[model samples]
Target: KTPVATLALAAETLENKHIVEKPDKLATYAGIVKYQSDHLSKQIEKLLRFAHTESGRLHLAKTTVDMHELIRESITHLMPLIQQKNATLQLNLNAAKSCMLADRDYMIIMITNLIENAIKYSKEPVIIITTINTPEHFILSITDNGIGIEKRHIKKLFRKFYRIRNNEEYVAKGFGIGLTIVRKIVSAHTGKIYVESVPAKGSTFTVELPGLK
Candidate 1:
């Protein structure tokens, strides 16, 4: 969706003859189009790489990922969902000036899926994203004031096709593969994931990655 929207914006910018007068804006849009094209391509590769029955372990391209920018882009991508749930996002990253030597595409996908999952079941729908950078590890914590998970269910949360439901009807519309992918991505980067929750209260997911050298 982001790729499509960005592509459309690029097209509009190109089609507008008046845009030629603004060379700077035209150049910016052109760069946006290129980036989104690469982004779209990577998404397709991820699907084919992981969606196949014969697929093996994941492969990654290591690069410096700006943690703050990645988180901001993820929140931006989820704007519609946040608005639909009437949610408020409180972000705290003043101390998170951290970077990861990892796959940028995978990081974006993992963060986006995590936040989207939070929005799906949030009771009061207030999400708080915080980050901590220490000598040992860099942590990103997403806290949601949602219908918290049960003790019996927390352990199985990262399993593929795992869905949460108290009864017959499904709680959300999803393939339940999002977290599984996130877990795999984290593992590939030698990171750790933790979940804390209390029924009727809320949940928090914290991902800890080793500090960049």
Candidate 2:
């Protein structure tokens, strides 16, 4: 169902007197409303981002931002979803050089989108977020034990509205612009993104940006 239909159905469900009388049922329906509201809001935000990117209105406010700190903040922002999905994020942020020149807001969005993808697409969401600061670049990787992408789909994942659909076991959702926005943000930062995956195994998305050493 579309988000509007889901929201309407959830709202209608909340009107049932029996559900209202039961606290657990009431909470569940209410949660559906909140979740759908958030989902719709995120979709709208993505649309605005897409418009800005297409119109060349997307601009970056660069500053000395710490990649480690941004990663932590992104995790905190996504804590509710993590708990809801029973997901665990193991962090290995041993990057001696963590600072970079980038837009902090866009960085958070990029990080959050990757981490959220890891959680949403995986049956067992044990995501590992690792960071490495090489002499020339800062690498951030989000690895998940999810329904990995096929080699054929790897090249098209960054295209707007493109999603992996070969797996019947796991049906991924959303407007499919998440990765496109992520790629745009990375490009704006003069970074490169890569993915390594094996079908039915897992996938790792790595973003390499210039580090401020």
Candidate 3:
């Protein structure tokens, strides 16, 4: 049977068996179902986005976007996770007044993934996000005091489904598709991603794109 059919049957079975009869049990089961549903939704969205990007169907509204404001907005959306981890979120947005010609949605997705990943693997409780404008390029950097990746894993980080096999101590909740999506989005905007890391020292991700006057 198809995956959706299988899931439907499982849900029906769970309901019919009355395994969630107690109020608390039912609530717990509901939470699990919701979490799975949300996870599936994100995966589907990512796949659709990837398909559109590959087919060149993704729409881009090339307008001037304030880099500093965009970064602050993205961090605000991720504030709960940062707070939950007791991690400090610092924004050294020197380029806040600088504008870039790009799609707002794509930039948001790129920044969101970078910040989220920083919060996820970080053990140092601090994250620094900064934006800089070079003579020819705009640079967005997210640095975290996380578990830090090894050199070998750096090359594969952008590959679809690629994940580092760290011990459970460093494992985060994900299907390992976020970076792949981020890479695609960055490339769609004619940008490149760079990484610098030392195991246990943390990692830094820098996105470089052509700057607009």
Candidate 4:
């Protein structure tokens, strides 16, 4: 069932008088209601942003953003998903110059999307996030021990609403717009994104942006 349907069913159960008599069942349904509501809200918000991106009306409120701090915050925000997946996050923030001019909110969304993708697709998620500051560029790389993409699919991964069809029994639930938004955000900041993967091994996504002035 979709999130909306699940939320409706959960809400109806919560309103049942008999549910109040079973505290454990009540709690479980209540949790479902909350989780589904959150999931629906997030999906709606992503769709709205995608519409804005498509219309070319997406605006960025530029500011000085600390990449390390933003990365840490993104990890914190996704801690629940990480723990649920038994994921291990290794942060290698080696960049001496960690600050850059970018839209803070968009950066947060982009970083969160990347990390969340890693966690969702991997069986045993071990994500390594690394940052490097070069003389002319700031590079952020996220590596995941996940079901790696094929070379043919990698090029199309950022296309709007494009999803890879695989034979796996379990597939991640998404509208397939997350990476599209990520790529748009990176492009708005005049950055370049790349991916490297070998089938059955893993994948690495790297975003390169202009160094701090």
Candidate 5:
């Protein structure tokens, strides 16, 4: 209801106002609608699925997905955030192996969350996404030069609603369930995810899912 109302209000505002001359205002409103719509859609779908599933576990529908294309799609969805942070997104999708057997929607969610996670933690973050096919698995790495996770916290990062900072130490605020959902998505595909980081240097998240035969 709120999302639909917001959308209607935005459309009405655009129709009533003359933003044609001010490209900046026009772009900001446009971006707002896009962000709100995307957020509402993702949340609604998750809520619907949760309501439907008896076990509360995410259901999977396997299909052949190209990793390069998936990352590109996720990046497109995150343009507003990317621009807001003045962050440069680098993609290294040159690897020969790019296919994965997974659920497209869930993979997109997983990748989107991971990318957003990286963007928030890093200062003047340069986000690098690399994907390739390995002999036994498809490898996806998201590397960022940001404040790295502490050794103790690294192990508990996947725990639901667990946050890293205690008010003073954390710069950005989050619900802290993004990685939990990402972990669930990877686990559903029987994949492995790991993180390596140094305190001030940066952090890298690596995911390896069994390759399609």
Candidate 6:
């Protein structure tokens, strides 16, 4: 989303120039400024979290959480984008709801990033969010029918500031920071993330966290 950030900053600069001659443009300029401001805010939050994690200042307040409920809450927050894309989002959660001990804020960030990535990459009409219960982990998967990443790019998907090359259509607007934050947040929670993708077939990101009673 760095590209978006740059665009926003440029817009702000332009807006300042037009303040005297074209005050009417302030509304449009304000919108762009706010968009960039919010994106930067998220990045700052991630940076703070990473700093805490590295310094061992990050502490988990373990509590039993209903996975399905958490997923639903995430979907609700992302519903606007899903609707804007004219894409359908389906939740196929298991009948069983597992309770896990973890920090609630971190879990929200993890799930939000996954859903955001799915929506950003999808080109298809529908997206699926599902969960599976295993003896050792609670598996959550976000699958999208969008332009999938190539096999070669899969390895670097989690690297900070690493983004896929040659997809100008997708690269034009994003700074490629979402997945990095996602990986860090998952790792902080003592979980793992996996990805499967085909250039045209789409991609699935699965996250596994300890499922405790």
Model 5 lDDT on a 0 to 1 scale: 0.81
Q: Tell me the whole-model lDDT of each prediction, alpha carbons only.
A: 0.81, 0.90, 0.79, 0.88, 0.81, 0.74
lDDT of 1: 0.81
Model 3 bad stretches (over 4 Å): 1-43, 54-58
Residues 1-213 of candidate 6 have per-residue lDDT tens digits of: 573656656665774655636766665566556655655677677776666665764577767788787888877766655665677888888737467887777788789888877777666547788888887889998888878888889999988668775557554245566687788778877899999988877889999988885
Q: What is the lDDT of residue 96 in candidate 2?
A: 88
Q: Provide the TM-score for each candidate, comma-separated.
A: 0.75, 0.94, 0.78, 0.89, 0.79, 0.77
User: What lDDT tens digits, residue by residue, belong to model 3 across residues 90-180?
Assistant: 7787763368899988888888888988987977568898888888888888999888999989999998778887786867666678898
Question: Cα RMSD to native, each candidate?
Answer: 7.9, 1.5, 4.8, 2.1, 4.2, 4.0
113: Cα error in model 5, Å:
0.9
Backbone-clash count (model 3): 1
Q: State which candidate, 3 or 4, has the greater lDDT.
A: 4
Which segments of candidate 4 are over 4 A away from where they belong? 8-29
Give the clashing residue pairs of candidate 5, or none: none
Candidate 1, 1-213: lDDT as tens digits: 467787997888788888867889788778778766765664565456458522766678889888888999998877756765788999988554588798888899889888987887875588999999888788999998777899999999988778898563317555567788888889988999999999778899999997777
lDDT (Cα, tens digit) per residue for candidate 2, span 58-148 = 5999999999999999999888678878998899998989999999999999999999999989987999999998899999999999999
Tell me the TM-score of model 5: 0.79
Q: After superposition, how far is residue 121 of candidate 4 from its true place, in Å?
A: 0.6
* Model 6 score (lDDT): 0.74
Q: RMSD (Cα, Å) of candidate 1?
A: 7.9
Q: Which structure is stronger by lDDT: 4 or 5?
A: 4
Q: Which scores higher on TM-score, 2 or 5? A: 2
Give lDDT for model 4.
0.88
Error of 6 at 33 (Å): 6.9
Tell me which residue pairs clash in candidate 2: none
On lDDT, who's better, 3 or 6? 3
Candidate 4 Cα RMSD after full superposition onto the native fold (Å): 2.1
Those runs of model 2 whose alpha carbons end farther than 4 Å from true positions after fitting are none
